[model samples]
Target: MDTWLKESRKRADSAHHVVPIRSGVLWSEALMRQSMPPSTADPDTSRPNRIPPDVPRNMHDSYCELLLPFASSPELLEQYINASGGIRTGMLMEHLDSLAGGIAYKHMLGPGVEVLSKDQGFYMVTASVDRLDMLAPLYPVRDMRLSGQVIHTGRSSMEVAVRMEALEKDGREQTIMLGRFFMVCRDAKTHKAAPVNPLKLSTPEDKQLFALGETHKDRRRLRTSVSLDRLPPTSLEAEELHSLFLHVHQKVFGGYLMRLAYELGFANAELFTGCHVLFVSLDCISFAKPVPIGSILRLSSHILHTTSSEQFPGLIHVGVQANVVDVATGKEQTTNDFRFTWCTDHNIPLTRKVVPKTYKGPCGERLGFSEELLQRTLTSKTY
Candidate 1:
C-alpha cells in the first residue's frame, strides 16, 4: 500500500506530458474523431485486438488509496459543501471515477507508472460499473478516503472494486459507500480488445473475491442474452404485468448504481427525489452500445425487484435502460442498463411493495440472480 501511495503522489506531480485545457471546442474535437465517408462515418466497430500473454499480478499490486481532508481543511470542505450544508456527493463521485481508472492502469502497468498516454501499449476504458451503493449516509465536515483494486480479470477486461470511507466520531474507518467497475483494455493503436494482467489468488480471501468477479461477468452475459431489444419479454413476465394492469386498470412506470456513478438513484441529478430512501447497494450496470452525435436517447426506469429486511420497509431493486435512435433510418439500439438498491422509509407501509402496472417495456431480469453478490457487497469490507 505504501508503494501504491507513492504512485498516487507521482500522478499528482507529473513532470512529463501535459496538455493545456482548451476552452469550448470539445464538440469540434469529437466530430474530427468520428468524421468519415458516407458509408463509414458510423461504421461498424473494428475487430477487437487479440489478447496478449501478460503476466498475472497479485491482488495487492493494484491496491491504491486517496484522501481528502475535509475535516482539517475548511476551504476544501467549503468547495464540497452543498447549499443545505451536506457535503457534495457528486464531486466525490467524480473522483471515484478517476480513481477507478487509475487503479485499472496500475493493474496492467506497474503501480509506479503515473502517466496514462497512448504510448503505454494499451488504453483502458470503463466498460461498465456493476454497482456503487451507499452503505451509510454522509456526515458533514469529515475527511474522506477512497481505495480500490482489480478484483477480477477476463481475457480482455478487469473487474475493479472500490470503496469510500469516512473517519467516524469514534475514530474508526466507516465505509460510507461501496462500488464495482468493469474496465476493458484496448490496443493503443488497433483500438480492439487487449489482454490484461490476471489476478493471482495468493489467499483464500483473494480466491473468494475473484469468484465474485467471475460471477459478476457471468451475470452480465446472462442479462445480455435476455435483453429486450434482442428478444421479447418472457411470456410469464408479460402475463404478470398484464394481470397487474387488469387489477389496477391503468398506469405504467419509469432506472442505476451507476456504471459511472448513478448506483441507486437518478444520475446525481439537480433534484434529489429519493428523500425518504437510503441507498443500499447496486447490482449491475451494462453498456450495450455508444450514442452517436445526432442520436436521440430514450431512458426507461423500473423497480425490477425488492425485499424487506428485518429493518427497513424494503430493499428496492431498480433498473434503467437507455436506447438510442437514428433519425435518418429510424434504427434503434439498446445503449445501457443499470441496477440499483436502496432502503425506503418503513413508516410508509405502501412503499414496502412496488407492483408493476404494465407489461414489461424494457428487460426486467437484471437482479434476479444477484442476491449473494449483493449480500457480500454489503458486509465484505467492514471495520
Candidate 2:
C-alpha cells in the first residue's frame, strides 16, 4: 500500500546536509550540528516543503503502517504476551494513541516531513478516544500490522481511525480491531485552538470513512446532550441498565463504555507506558426515576455482598443510591440505585458482608430478589 515507511526508503539531502525526512527516522543531521556551535542563519531561511494551512490534504497522504513481527521474533513477542498467552491489549492501545498523534502531525506537515519543528505553527494532542471496538480476539501466533490515516477534520479537531490486523502465515490479514481517536491541534506558541487542513475525499472509501467520522462527531454530541451525568436515562434505557446490573456485561451498557473509554485509556497509561487497567464491570441496579434539572442529588453507596471465604474472590457488590430533595417540602427521595464491581490496580476489601441500617436498605435488597419483579417483567409486553 506504500504506507509502511522503511529504512531503505530514507534518503539524505547532502546539499543542505539535511537528514532523511520520514516518520521513523531516529537520527537527524542536526545531531552533528548539536556538537558544533549554533548557526545563526538569516531568520527568514524559509523552511523547506512546508504545506500551507489552507491546502486540502488527501486521506492517503497521512497513511502509515507499523509491523509487529511477532511470529518471526519470539524474544520480542515475549514482551507483548500476556498471562493468557495473547497479545496485551493495553500495549496496543498505547501504540494506537501514538499512531493517531503521528497521523495528525503528518496531516499538518507534508507527507515526508520528519521533524515536528517548534516553528511549525501547530501541534497535535490526543483530546479523547471516541471509540474502540474489538471485532475479534487477537492471537499471539500471528504477526500483526497497525495502520491508520486522518479521516476527517474540523477547525481545531480531527478524527484519526486506526486498524489492527492479524497477518496470517499464508499472507492473509484478518481485521482484529478498530478505533477512532480525537486529536486537537493547538498553535505551538499560543497553545490555543488552531485550524486544521480540510480533508480531500477522492474515492468511495474516502467518502465513506469521512462520513463515519462525521457520524462519530454527531454521536458524541448526542451522547453529551443525554449523558448520564447531565441528563437522566429514559425508561427503556433504565430497564436495559437493570439487566446490566444483573449481568454486569458490556452489550447492555455501550453508552457507559464510551463515556468511560477516555478515563480507562489514560488510567492504563499511568505508572508506565503499558500499565494494565482492567474495566471489571459497571453495574447500575436500578434507574428508578430521572433526576430533574437543577435538583441537588445526594449520592451514597452501601456494600451488599462479599463472601467471607476467598474461593470466588475479588468481588464486592455495592449498592449506590441517588437521593434528591424536594425544594418546596425539603424531603429527600431515592431516585437511583447502582451496583458497581471493580477490579484493577486498586482494591476495595470487604471482610464478610454489610448490613444497611436505613429503612430502605433491607427492602431494596429484598426487592432485587423479589418474585413480583420477575412476574411483572414477564407480564409486560415490552420490558
Candidate 3:
C-alpha cells in the first residue's frame, strides 16, 4: 500500500506539467523560443511514458489506486471531530474528486493523444456525482485505500468509478463508499466541450461496466428532465430551507457545495426522523450550472422516505435541491439535485414517518416528479 501511494503521487506530480497548456499558446514552439534564452531554446520537458505502459488506450489504462494513512488533524478539526473520530464527509469528497481527475488524466494520456500540446489538451470538470453509496462508515484511525478507474467514455464525457475502503487493524479491508463521477472533457483553449476517446471493451467486465454507464446516463437524463429543483419550492417546504441559504460573496468551491448539500440533507433527515444521524449516501446529484461568485445559494432538503436495514434499522432519505437566488430579480434558478441518506444514531428505530404534503399546482407537479425520481433512485439496482 505504501509503495502504491508513492507511485501514485509520483505519477500525479508528473502529470502536473501537462495542465499548463490549457491556454493553447503556452506550449507553442514560437512562444517557447521567444520566452527562453538562446542557450535553452527547447528543453526536452515532455517526459513520455511516465504513466504505466500497460495503462493505455482502454478502460484498463485509466486505473488509479492510492493508499493513505490518516494523521492527526490540526487544532480546529481535531477539536471538532475528536469525539466522533472520523474525517469529515467533505474531506472524503475532496479525495474522491482528486483521484477521479487523476484517472481521467491517465485516460486522456494514451497513444495518439497529445500529452503536451497547446492546441489540444483534455481538461475535465466533474459534471455530476451520479451515485455515491455508503457501504460503511469511516473513522479517522483506519487507513484509507482508494481505487479509481474509467468505466465508460462518451463523446465528451467519461464515467469514473471510485471506491473507498478502510483498512482494519488485522489486515482486512472493508468497502466503505462507492461513487460514480461523470466528468466532461472540454477544450483547454475554447473552454468548450471536446471530443474524448471512446472506451474499447475487450473483456466481459469491460462490457458490463460500459452497459452500467449507459444505464446510468439514461436514468440521469430522465430524472433531470423532470427535476423538481428546476421549479420553485412549495410554501410548506420553504420554511425549512429558508434558514439554510448561504450568501456566497466569493467563488464557489465544488467540495464546499458538496458539504453544504450534505449538511442540508442530514439536517432535514434529523428534523423528520427526530433522530441524530450520520450521512450514509448521496445519489443522483447533478450540478446544473457553474455557480458564480456572490450568488445567493439555497439548499432545500425534503424528506422523501425512510427505510430500515439489517445493520441500521432507521435510515432516512432526504432530497436536497440547490438553487441560485437572484436577489435583485427575486427569482431563483435550480443549480443541483441531490439525494442523501442518513443513518440514525445509536441504531434507534424510527417510528415516525415524514409524509410529504400534496402539491396541486404546477409547482406541486414538479415536486411530484421530484418524489418519483427519489423513489426510483432508492429502488434502482446499481452496478
Candidate 2 per-residue C-alpha lDDT over 275-302 given as tens digits, one digit per residue, 9 for 90 to 100: 2333223322333444444566666555
Query: Judged by lDDT against the true structure, how good is candidate 1?
Result: 0.59
Per-model TM-score on C-alpha atoms: 0.65, 0.53, 0.68
Model 1 Cα lDDT, one tens digit per residue, 79-151: 8776656765656666776678778877776555544432355666666666676777787667888877777
Q: By TM-score, how accurate is candidate 1?
A: 0.65
Q: How does candidate 3 fare on TM-score?
A: 0.68
Clashing pairs in 3: none
The true-structure Cα RMSD of candidate 3 reads 9.4
lDDT string for model 3 (262-373, tens) is 7667667777877578777676666656687668888787877677767767878777788999998989988777767787889899998766576521222355435554
Candidate 3 or 2, higher lDDT: 3
- Candidate with the greatest TM-score versus the true structure: 3
C-alpha lDDT values of all predictions: 0.59, 0.55, 0.64
- The alpha-carbon lDDT assigned to residue 73 of candidate 2 equals 98
Ranking by lDDT: 3, 1, 2
